[model samples]
Target chain A: MSQILRREAIYALTGLVTVLMLLEYFFWPTAQPWAETIRTWAIIVFNISLGLGAIRLLMQQSMNVQKRRENWQYSAMLLSLFVVMLLTGFAGYFATGLQTSNGIYNWLFINIYTPLGATLYPITGFYIFSAAYRAFRARNVDAALMLIAGCFVMLKNAPVGEAIWIGFATIGNWFQFTGQIPGMRTFSIVGALGLIAYGFRALMGKERGFYAGGE
Target chain B: MWDVIGLWIGWLLMLMIYSYPLYKENPAFRTAEHMFIGVTLAISIITNFSNVMRMCVTPLMQGNILMIVPLVLGLMIFSMLIPEYQWVSRYPIGLLVGTGFGLGIRGTIKPNLQDAIIDTITAPTSGGAMAWFNFLYVAVGLICSIMYFMLTFEHKGPLQGPTRIGRLFIMVGLGGYFGNTVLFRFTMLTGRAQFFLQVLKLIPM
Candidate 1:
């Protein structure tokens, strides 16, 4: 196609697709059959994506093993665990007869995955403490204020602050409830708008990054 | 039984990789990093597709032609993948943006502006000093945060005080961010450790 023709086709396609999506969003049919059909296609694509992920995991593990990398052992372990999980999950589905018992997949997910996932958040305490020690310097007026506010909030988050200064607890609560929360909300709203705009530009084929020849 | 032993060994191996980052950048660490990124991306794709098919695609396919809207919009996202046909992504992007803006405006107008304004105006003093401090916090925090965004003009005689207050609020905000980062990092460390501990002992199970 000619340059102008390509551009026109792209724009027209994007515009048409956009209209369809907007229409669908506003006037979603209240019928169950339509919902089910949509659900099937979504699952098929998602499953294909999952299979791709498993392949990626296997590839990385193989690479690590070949290179004899130090953490190669870990990579191997990850692949093994993933395979086991995948197998057990599939097996359990097929052998639905033994579904009542503590199936292999269920046990592993609850005991292993659940704890590991939950710990991800709580484990940040060390990094936070170390980072604070390194970066909490009051190099400027703004930095100083940040340090003070951060300290206050940190203290207030825990019971120790209340023990040290009764006012700290209340102050922390007020800062979060009044200041921090509202500020973050505004930032999120503005950030989301920017994200949507960028997403649109990308989808319209306006995004040069997606092009094989980088613009 | 074999799986159990393998899981324990895997946990140990993962912990070792996690520790490599604290020491120095090494092949082991890099390998672990690559593996993590690859696995996570893959899983996310799978889960999302599973959910979309279950919730969206299947419904439309089974005589629910109306459900074609989001699917087509979503597929339009792939126009970005087609190099020559990439401009098709714009349609979905536009739809996403329009809906996002609508939802955001609807959600934000009342809570962010209206409620905040009302709270600022209705200062309370029922709890003595504590209440006074809270009232001041609301007043100052609102004004200062807003003032910080005022870049249209330079701060001069009258604007100096508000500008200074804005700077102060900003500092406070930065501090909060620092604290959060520190907390997050520590959490990562704890997570690695917990993984090791859980594998070493069956108690966590």
Candidate 2:
């Protein structure tokens, strides 16, 4: 009985929101005011919900510390840093009306957080090189073609390739414009159709994965 | 002076974090990883709170009663923490999903499907031989690629040819994408390397 009520609530809410949005799209003058209100509400709700992630993180890390688990010291460090950052942020916001630009917050962010974020993408460079060495082997006709095309495109992109042969750019551009765009467009269209179908299924309550435990 | 010192420290810490994975994962890497997650979450929470204050709280304080509806709806999300009333959380999820779908469908249909079809159909056929050839190539490629995704028909006999061509086009497209991605990653590495070199005064500007 409870499950049925939950499902019904989900359906009702979904249907209501979707219809409202559709009305906003089609009949702008009529639904504009209500739609704007709803949109603002959605944004507020979404932003508030973002803290749930932080809460979950705190819960897990605190558990690790409490249980004295292996690498619990790291968890301790994590929690301490989290508290310091959070406190500094709130304090800055209250004091200066800007949390991010506060001296301590700015220093920590620029020194620690920014560097950590920047390093993550570049680290993938080494991994991709390793993977390419294994994956780019020309074992068959299709593989050989792909390897040749990939090599051309890669060379065209690199400065050394331009120094070696200027024609690499021309060939690469031709491949991208003539070969890639059409294929990509078809994929995009297909994907969009899939999205629409999935949306409809969700609207009809045929897709219940959004419900916890898939109820 | 202090900012310069902080920048240098940042560069060194970044290098250490990145280099650890090349050898073997160690405690330093794990600590840094945890620190990153913690800092990120802290920043996210603060940012979200600030947004709520500006968008919802401020408006309500200014005598807007409508804000209460969303405040209540948003608060309902925390019900998930209580197992007995967890289902209440589904209301917000449903609304969000519905809004997302409605917006996405309305936005995607014209741009992804209609515009693409229109562009393909209106492709110029009355240029030089090369231009005409390019147009034909795009048209055929688009058709074949679209056909490849038609799961209703088995790729046998006459259907096999187009499907094969479609697969080849897809491979080429994916290869191009992969190459671009590799180049982008290399460029990022170069930027980091440049920063490190400059910080150490090893490279002249």
Candidate 3:
């Protein structure tokens, strides 16, 4: 009985929400406000869901520390920092009656968070160069053509490349303008169609892999 | 005063964390990794709490009783914590998925499909030699790339030629993407290097 109810609720909710959204798009006169409300509700629910992740993190880290697991000291450090950051953020908001943009919270974000986040992408630079050296070998016709194109584009971007030969910039521009844009557009259109088909399946509840008990 | 010091400290910490994988993994790297994850999660939680309070809680408290429906649905997600009630969480997940599909499908159909087709068909065809070449190139690229994706028909006889040409065009397209990615990474490296050099007084701003 419970299983049947659960399945029914899932199908009904999905169908109702999807139909409401389609109505809003196709027949905007009636369903506008309701569709807007549903969107707002989704956002609210998404915000609430963020706590689920924090809760999971807390539980796992606490367990690690309690059991004296390998690298438990790191887990303890994580928990300590987590609590400190959370407290500082909440205290800043409550004390100032403003968002986290002011006080100690902002300071922590600018100094610690922003710097740490920024380093992530730049670090990828080293990996890209390492990979290019290994992969960009001109062993065949196709690979040679691609390597030549990549080298031209890379040189055209760098100051030293232009200083070495002005023609590199001209050829690079020609390749990008004449070749890349149309190909990219074709790929984008195809990708978008795939997304639409996937979305349709999800709306119809045919894509049930996201559900708890789903295959 | 303190902000400048903090910025420098942050930069140093970032460099230290990033340098770890280059060398062997050690305790210092592990400690930094843990701190980074914990701090990031804490910030995320605080931001979400603020958004919920401002958007949902405040409005509901101010007499928007209809907001209760979504609030309850949001709360239903917590049912996943209890083994017996986990299936109930599917309701909200279903609603989210449906809403996302509806939003995405409507938005994608017009710009990605309709506009793209119109743009390709009506692209300027009459001009100088270079202009004509570009027009033909784009047209051929579009048609051949589209044909390459046609899975219904097997490539044989006359169709084999176009399919092979289409594959080459696709390869060229992929090559362009690879080149662009390399340029982006190089640019990022240059920016970070410039900052570090400035800090060390090796170069002027």
Query: Pick by TM-score: which candidate is best?
Result: 2
Error (Å) of candidate 1 at residue B106 is 2.2
Where does candidate 2 stray beyond 4 Å?
A: A1-4, A27-29, B125-127
Model 1 segments beyond 4 Å from truth?
A1-127, A162-215, B180-195, B202-205
CA shift of B144, model 2, Å: 1.3
For model 3, residues A57-143, the per-residue Cα lDDT tens digits are 889999999999998999999998888888988887777655474567778777778767766667778888888888788887767
- Candidate 3 to truth, TM: 0.91
Please, what are the lDDT tens digits per residue for candidate 2 over residues A63-154? 99999998899999999988889899998999977897678887888888988888776898988998999878889877877777788888
Query: What is candidate 2's lDDT per residue for B1-205, written digit by digit as tens?
Result: 8788888877777767775757778776787788888888889989888989899989999999999888888888888778888888888777678888888888899999999988877767577887777788888888888888988899998889998888877777777888888989988988888878878889863
Ranking by lDDT: 2, 3, 1
DockQ of each: 0.21, 0.74, 0.65
Candidate 3 chain B weakest ten by summed lDDT: B166-175
Docking class of 1: incorrect
Q: What is the Cα-based lDDT of residue B15 in candidate 3?
A: 72
Which pairs of residues collide in candidate 2? none
Candidate 1's displacement at residue A26, Å, is: 13
State in Å the error of residue B63, model 1. 1.4
Q: Could you tell me the TM-score of chain B in model 3?
A: 0.86
lDDT for A203 in candidate 1 is: 52
Per-residue accuracy of model 1 over B14-60 as CA lDDT, tens digit each: 65455553576576555545444443443344345546666666677
